[model samples]
Target: MTTLITGATGKTGQRVAHRLQTLDHDVRGVTRHSTPRFDWHDRTTWAGAVDGCESAYLTFQPDLGLPGADEIIGAFAAQAVAAGCTRLVLLSGRGEDGAQRAEQAMTASGAEWTILRSAFFMQNFTEGAFADELAAGSLTMVEHTVAEPFVDADDIAEVAVATLLDKGYVGRVLELTGPQLLTFEEAARAVGGPGVAYLSMPTEDYITVLTEAGLPAADAAGLAYLFEEVLDGRNAYVTQDVETVLGRAARSIDGLAGGEQS
Candidate 1:
């Protein structure tokens, strides 16, 4: 079956695309840089990406927690339905209002949808927004000892591909997480050597650093709130959805850290 993967070059999307392609599935990857670009802000670009695909893995750029994301995702889901796409898999975050709204939109869309509400990714230290800071030998965040069950992106991609190919997970909102909970210091120690420091800074101070590093004000504030508010002992528990969907234990952060690539 033909499948379109939006944000095709991203951490999770790239893994999903590769897994699908290895299985001999016809895959089309769309990015803002693609020939028929799939810019989420441009409606005209949406149709071109959806046209010829029977299934799609949709990952919103920046994040689903951004303002107006609900409306944007809803519009794109409608377009995918009109283009004859039958199955949709949405990547979303847990405990965010906007993500909940976006999930609602996907549910109402005509296509059969699966919502993957994920915890913080372990790959964040190696390949994501936190990589640069970790490489610089220091990562800063708000000083909360609340631990999170950071899941692996590989697990997420596997689940997404499964959702697309299997009918069992349709209409299910899967909460994915790793097998254990870890604090930022513990996580840093897992990824980086002892020399790499995990500094717990004040929320406002961290926001200042983010803005100084060139993130927009809205984004910086959102991140500060995410680290300070959402992470306040809320998502400390682990889930078995990964095991349920993949029929195996969820990959642990320790396993990911000891691998060739972090």
Candidate 2:
């Protein structure tokens, strides 16, 4: 059975594609600019990408919490089902209210659904915004010294591909997280080194740095909003979802960033 994966170039989606292809599955990588072109903003492109596929690994680009994501996800799910897609695995954010709305839309879109709810990814340090900060030897995060159990994209991908390729995982809400919890400073130190320090800057300072670095005003504002809104001491817990799914505990944040062992 062929499976189409949206956002196939992203941190988690790329791993999912690798896992699927390694197993020799007829994996289809869908993007906004593929030969058939599958832009999230265009409902017309999804039909071509999802055509004749029995399953789809749906991961919205930018983010599912972005404006009007629900409408777009709902429309795409409907089209996929109409085009004969049977199962859908939705990658959703953990504890974001908007994400729940989008997940419900997919659930009601006439396709069997499995939602993988995940907290902040550990890859943010090695591959994203935190990368520069780690390299700079300082990380000024707005989190209030709270612990967060970050999940690895590879682990999340393994579970997603398993659910997509192997059956019997329908209607499950797998909340993926790391095996241990680490505060923002601790998390930062793990990636960089003992020289790294986490500074709790004021919201205004945070906005200033983000803006000074040439980030758009809207994106800079959104970055502050994430630390202030979604990460207000609420995402500090460990879970066994990864172990349960992959038959082993999720990798730790420090281990992920640690240099190769001698």
Candidate 3:
């Protein structure tokens, strides 16, 4: 039996698949266009995606906040059950109501579940949303000027891999956060590169910038909602979950921003 990874194209999922493979586990990924196509928007793919799977790393793409995400998750949980998948490691976002809803659905699915609730990823700057802006010498976030302890994608992946491969994580909601919090400017400064400026702007202004950047309106809206509603000091506090799960302190942004001059 294989451990299926959803959203295999994403940063976290990519890391999870690699980690699982490194451990010599039978791992397979679900992608819309892959040999085993796993499109969450297409339920017909779920059965095939979960086929011959004893466990799964479930990461919803676009986001868990999308319309009907909860319903889709619940349905998928049922499919996992029918497919004989006993372990379901769900990737959930901290402070995200939609993720919480999806979590509840997974829990109620009757499978041994592990919810890896994670903080915002630091990869957003290098591999995700802020990558381009960072490259362009401008980075924008919802909060005008507050530090967020962005969790490393590797940390999230390691924790998820552990939960998926080990039984100790069953029924646990491991909330992994970075060791410290830093404002966007602090994070940029920590990048310690030639020069990275972090600016704080109003949520509306941030939304406008995102909209102007060619992101769909809905994505811009959700991002604005995340920044204004969720990231507004709610995630500034650092936690030891990373240390607890990985048996080591979380990696610092400075180390992660490798080769950048402060």
* Candidate 1 error regions (>4 Å): 260-262
Query: For model 3, how does the per-residue alpha-carbon lDDT over 1-262 read when each residue is reduced to its tens digit?
Result: 5999988889898898998888888888878888778888898888888888999999887788655788999989988987799799998887788778989988889999999878778888788878877887866666644467778888898888777777988998888888888777777656536587666678788888888989888878776876676665666688898898778888877767884311
TM-score of each: 0.96, 0.91, 0.92
For every model shown, the clashing-pair count is: 0, 0, 9
Superposed by TM-score, candidate 3 places the C-alpha of residue 24 at a distance from the truth, in angstroms, of 1.3
Tell me the lDDT of model 1 at 53. Answer: 93
Q: What is the lDDT of candidate 2?
A: 0.82
Model 1 C-alpha lDDT per residue in residues 1-262, reported as the tens digit of each score: 7999999999999999999999999999999999779998899898888888999999997888878889999988988898899799999998887789998987788889999999999999999988999988888888797999999999999999999999887889999999999998888888887788888988898889889999998889877876786688878899999999999999988787788432
Tell me the spans in candidate 3 whose CA falls farther than 4 Å from its real position. Answer: 192-194, 259-262
* Winning model by lDDT: 1
- By descending lDDT, how would the candidates be arranged? 1, 2, 3
TM-score leaderboard ranking: 1, 3, 2
lDDT of 2 by residue, 1-262 (tens): 8989888888887888888898888888978767678898877677789887999998986667655778888888888898899799999987776778899889889888899998788888878778887888988877475678888878899889888866678988999998888777888888888789778887778888888988887667665765676677666777798898889878877667775311
Q: Deviation in angstroms for 181 in model 1?
A: 0.3
